[model samples]
Target: MKRTFLLFTMLTTPSVSLADNAVNVVSWGGAYSQAQDDAFNTAFEAQTGISVNMVDADDPAVPLQAQILAGNVTTDVASLGYSDATRLCDENMLMLIDPATLRPAPDGTAAVDDFLPGGLSDCFVATDVYSTIIAYDESKFPENPPDSLADFFDTEGYPGRRGVLKEPRFTLEMALMADGVPAAQVYEILSTPEGLDRAFAKLDTIKDDAIFWEAGAQPPQLLVDGEVVMTQAYNGRIFNAAVDDGKPLKVIWDGQIYEMDGWVIPKDAPNPDDALAYVTFSTDAQALADFAMQISYGPPRKSAASLVGNYKDTDIPMTPNLPTTAQNMANALAFDNDFWVDNLAQLNERFAAWLAS
Candidate 1:
């Protein structure tokens, strides 16, 4: 376990006066919105003497794209999907913050090592880990539940209308898994032309059973309304919805497609140094844990998982209780940013054709 020494000077430099200059941050609004606003922003102001001007965006990509195209970067830091981060990096719109400068080490190894493998990019660093899984109404399937991706596609066995996202990433992966590829082999199969076609063909089998979801919040509602018996959903969103509505919903973690979201600084941000400090502060163990506990997103930092006690006793074993410990987070699949960046336009075209066909 590696730990970086906190840079005391960065907190005390006279020139870098911690005035109430509001650092801007943009994120998806919902439970995550309120959690970040109440927990992270409040603690940040107390510790750094810098206030935050928080902006909540329902569709983060549109506003972020608009800001970048208009040459006006309003947000100092933005929480974006891995695909979105890759797009921003390609567009030359992100600023890089040296990990060492963010938190100095006495021996001077980059603080990047403390992060999970594939969590850090040149311009972005992962902040949270989430999963897209099959969530079902437990009351309906009281005798037995679909436990894996294969079971999800077994319309005769499960016998209910299913909900799948309108996007390709998880849908393609789930299709491959149902077609009998192991979880680890999902992307490898999809990487090849034959495998990609096979996955799509398998998906076509259940196309009639699926009600495609367009928004993050919609899947849970569909589940609650009995529009679909089981649906693919973000684990945090589903968990929060279940808790709120007292719905007898349970997430099937087997064959779940996990994703990471991160904080990115714009290339020409006005307060680069302050931005680095803010990023570091946000990733600190306690703040990270509080953020995760308040909302259900898992923490990307190893230390952050230890700080949150509630996770240890959750319905699903908290990260620390698993076979792959938080420290060895390298095992998780790195979402293939390059593939998505290169193929999204073409893939979207093909997907539209498939959906209509």
Candidate 2:
């Protein structure tokens, strides 16, 4: 752990030469950021001699968007969710990343060919597959723990506040699923005005009982603090909390909402050329595989799966803990990126109004 932190310091320290040579990176902090520090920052700097300056954000897109609009884009590369990456690219706020420029798998498979379907976007390069799932601290429900999405909304059944993301993306989808909508039919049902309304109406059942969270890191902390018995959390966050922090948190994979988190160079990035250099090194098959060892997220490249091992400092193999693991994925929902890309604004407007009211 000391070694990793020191590596991050060496790689991210803003020396006098940093601005000229470093690529500024913004990411969701805590263990996730540490994962990238191990998987990306140190290796990229060592190989290319380009320093990296790291920054944390609740969501990198928020500050990165501000940077682009202020016409003072400072960060060279910021990690983002798929829908956010697509939306920013749609708004022409991010640089187009051609797959041809990225390094492929060591087995001679093209990078584009090796990456999972829908993994490549015109402007974003995918890093890893992460998920939002139900996680509860075991101390509360030691006898009979929460297992499914239904339990998340079943305040009367579970009898505790449920911490959920304040945003509508995973929240709405999970609500609909809890209301008995099948995973495969979630987005289809959520497409209609009535469908969306039904999802919110389901949430209304537990509105008073819901302890909403805004940041990716909050759900785990909420569980630790006894704020919520069960919360919707990024699978990787909960895994780290359980394994590393020994928090006794347990993730229930039923009705899990899974998606990829990718990298995007903001439009007018201060260091466009070097930023691309960083992305090329960081998103390669081996790099992503190395990244998965630090965090439970699954590598986007199919070939990269062969290279994945156990979690950092543990014998617990990383694959079965990953959202994409067959055992865990049995009832997973592939978070519809296109659906969110199209309906995000409208739904979020509705969600905000609902929350305020």
lDDT of 1 by residue, 163-190 (tens): 9889787788778877888767767778
Clashes of each: 3, 0
Task: Assess each prediction's global lDDT (C-alpha) against the native.
Answer: 0.70, 0.84
- What's the distance in Å from true for residue 220, model 2? 3.0
Q: What is the lDDT of residue 300 in candidate 2?
A: 85
Which residue pairs in candidate 1 collide? Answer: 94-267, 95-266, 95-267
Per-residue alpha-carbon lDDT of candidate 2 for residues 187-290, written as tens digits (9 for 90 to 100):
99999988988999998988898888888789999999998899889887898788888899998999998889889998777889999999999988889989
Count backbone clashes in candidate 1.
Answer: 3
Q: Which ranges in model 1 have alpha carbons more than 4 Å from their true place? A: 1-20, 60-72, 103-110, 311-334
